[model samples]
Target: MSQKVERYYVPAQSPWPIVGAVALGMIAVGAGNYVASLPDGGGYSGYLLLAGIALLLYMLVGWFRNVIDESMSGLYSAQMDRSFKQGMAWFIFSEVMFFFAFFGALFYARMLAVPWLGGAGNNAMTHEVLWPTFEAVWPLVSTPGGTTTEAMGWGGLPLYNTIILVISSITLHVAHTSLEQDKRKPLTIWLGITILLGLAFLTLQVEEYIHAYREMGLMLSSGIYGNTFFLLTGFHGLHVTLGTIMLIVMFFRVAKGHFTPANHFGFQASSWYWHFVDVVWLCLFVFVYVL
Candidate 1:
């Protein structure tokens, strides 16, 4: 007799995706309106933004629960596992492309546009007609328009945050190793510590931002340098926040005896994401702060 091949399981239509789309739409509109209203006064947009975020969170929780239940029940096959892994790989690749665009902008400004504005490429007439006193410089402390601001140094809080994130990455890797080795206690402990470290990194990042605004005079409107600095770091911080949340969810799943030594794609995906975020931060620290 021939061995039987298991039929692929197809899930029922999910309403969560459409609900998520609606939630995201509301969030975008609400956030835009809320920020636009900030110059005047508060408005209903703020409330709408909060409601959208809450609803989105709820949807995530429920959707994840259903997926977890299905996985635990062995509904997902090896092919499904491969599909999930590939999906995560592509997602991370997309993120890499997103950051690549920002880094490209930074390079274009620093290496090309700024120099072009300073009379490079036989543009002497252009500079003389425009910013006659403009000097091309890395960190660009003063704009061609004569608006001056201090460049943020790489020491102090930024250095400390770097150390924290690097350590967290190591701890998370050790946790993954422990999971592979089936050492539950070490896995839990290391994973918990990793989460705490992520939280600490976020806290220090917020403090750094506050110091930048209040003490360093580094606002989003400071100049092109400031614009690139905040947008790059701010987006990285948001990704770290999301990665931390994913790790927290994995921590709970581990506590509940969910993943085994061989089957833990969820944990593995979260780890990959956390490491990607750490790598992005390292790049930011070098390009944005040190370089």
Candidate 2:
């Protein structure tokens, strides 16, 4: 008896990676300059940021189209499927580390740096010489430079957004279950609802930011509290936006009869990403907003 070995399909060389790198580079430079020019209004850097985002969208569409074509053409084998699973798993793990670093910074500031500055561990002289007026509060509303800002509470928009995201995750899981059962109508309806929920969350977050900056005086340049709050929430918002885009794409693909009950790794990958985003938001609500 002879055993059959599956041959893994290797994709041809592509230019999408380089394109994505260039796009990211542009976005970084643009965002840096835009932030630096803030409160004075962004100049050319804003345009550069938009251009980079456009290029990134183009790259995503093209790369996804290529992969979809290959998959639909029966070029993918079980080995390829396993490879994709591994790749997506590692990608999500990398995202976990990215958030870990941000959360670590928050913890260090709260647990160590703030206390040390306020004379917690026999550094009273240091505090006296530096800024004896410093209060060392968790949400340090007052800066060393005498700039004060109100803290954003977890009551209104933040709480609503949290509820929205939690519900979106449930809807997305229902959509995935529908896909697994080969029920296209329910899958489309549930996935569409998930996307709407994601958009609603983003909208509420934007409104919250507006209220913070305009009324609460919680600008990015406010102090350490503002810095951590914006950094964590801003990055999480970006992730939510990307996840929503992914879900939108999956919705269209489902409409085109792309995924099947047996094999739908693309849809599965998007679901994993959506769930990860939801989990991140829950953490943000707890650490950044509530506690």
Candidate 3:
């Protein structure tokens, strides 16, 4: 018997893509203008940003709903699943490169720029001529331009958040194991715990930011240290938030008995993303906090 040739699943043309593109464009423009206006009076960019976020959320809900419907209807073949896996792999790889750029910047600043500015290497003359009082230091307490700010310590909130995230990842993994074993209750409980841990971690992060700004005087303008600290931690927190939301969706799907052990690509993808975020946080804890 000859093997039957199945046709590839081709989704109908949809307006969601264009809508998503426009929403992202608006968000980019709004974010740029909002940052620019922060030093002065607030501008319309804030409203535009809100609008863009709302539109993006709307688009995401619709897109995800359509995908879920198609998946549930069994419109997806093995080839489609392979395609999704490949697409997700590329997406994660791209994300790795995105973070690499920031990490490279952190490395350059610590290894080269700071030392060069503090009268090291061939730039001793440059430092002497530009900033005679400058001194190179990790967790830079003072900038070359004389801005002083207290350093965020790794003892309390950061340590707690790290534990929370590490445990969350483990819990998510256990949830996956439970799903594979066809134990729905344990799966639901573990997934819920993971989501709660994520929420608590985010709360502590916000508290840490408040402490940094109010008590430590560590605002974004507090020099390169503050800038890098906020940029890294802030973005990580955003990822955690997104991961939490994805898990929430997964939880609902689990309740509806959507995923089978043999066919749980959605759950697997979300779990992979959550694990990735956790790994990134570990790196942040080591380099951005401990070091």
Candidate 4:
């Protein structure tokens, strides 16, 4: 006896991606103008940015609502599962590439740029004239450009957050398994715990950011270290926020009996996104903090 493998099903059409693009346009343009107005003492163009973000968020809600309805109605076949998995894989791949870009910058600055500035490559003038005090350190705590910053060590808040996030991933997996077994209580309890862990992680992250800014005097304009640190972790946090929202939505849907064991693409997709974010955080901790 042979079991039939599932194939993916494609939907007829979706308008939300287009609407999302339009929202992105508004946001990008408004952000540009808002920044441009900073020196001139007029930054009110952020209103357009707010509008764009709101519209995009609305679009996401409507679009996901429809998909949830479809899956609950059993319109999604096993074929559709394949499609969803493939789509999530590709999305995670793209995320990997995005993080790679930041990692590439980190590597270049560490292995090449800093060393060159320290006269590692026969650039005597660079070291002697430009950077008399630079020593080509890995973290570059003190830059040749005269910016000083304290690097975060790999203990305390970060380690705790790491353990919390790992637990979150485990709880989420258990919740998914509960759903498959049609056990509502365990699913709700586990999902609720996962959400709380996520919120705790975010709270710790914000506190860390505040500590960096206040106690350490590190800032966005501090140096390249500050730049890369904030960019990598900040963007990862944004993704986590989005993932948490998705998880909350799925939590509500599950309470309403929206997904069965055989048809839970939305829940699965959100779980995949959360794991992707978790992996990204690991990379950030290694490169940005520990390494």
Best candidate, TM-score: 2
lDDT of 3 by residue, 28-72 (tens): 899779867866744899888889888988998898899999999
Q: Compared with the true structure, what per-residue lDDT tens digits does model 2 show for residues 114-184?
A: 99998887887777888878777889998888989998888899999999999999999999999999999
Candidate 1 lDDT over residue span 185-229, tens digit each: 999999999999999999999999999888877877678988899
TM-score of each: 0.92, 0.98, 0.96, 0.88
RMSD of each: 2.1, 1.0, 1.4, 3.3
Candidates sorted on lDDT, descending: 2, 1, 3, 4
lDDT of 4 by residue, 14-68 (tens): 8898999999898889877875675464366789888998988999898988887
Clashes of 4: 3
| lDDT (Cα atoms) of all candidates against the true structure | 0.90, 0.93, 0.89, 0.83
Residue 251 local lDDT, model 2: 90
Where model 3 places Cα greater than 4 Å from the true spot, the runs are 39-41
Q: Write the number of the candidate with greater lDDT, choosing between 1 and 2.
A: 2
Best by lDDT: 2
Cα deviation at 106, candidate 4, in Å, is 0.9
Screening candidate 1 with a backbone cut-off below 3 angstroms (N, C-alpha, C), the clashing residue pairs are none
Between candidates 2 and 3, the one scoring higher on TM-score is: 2
**lDDT score for candidate 3 against the true structure:** 0.89
Error of 2 at 23 (Å): 0.5
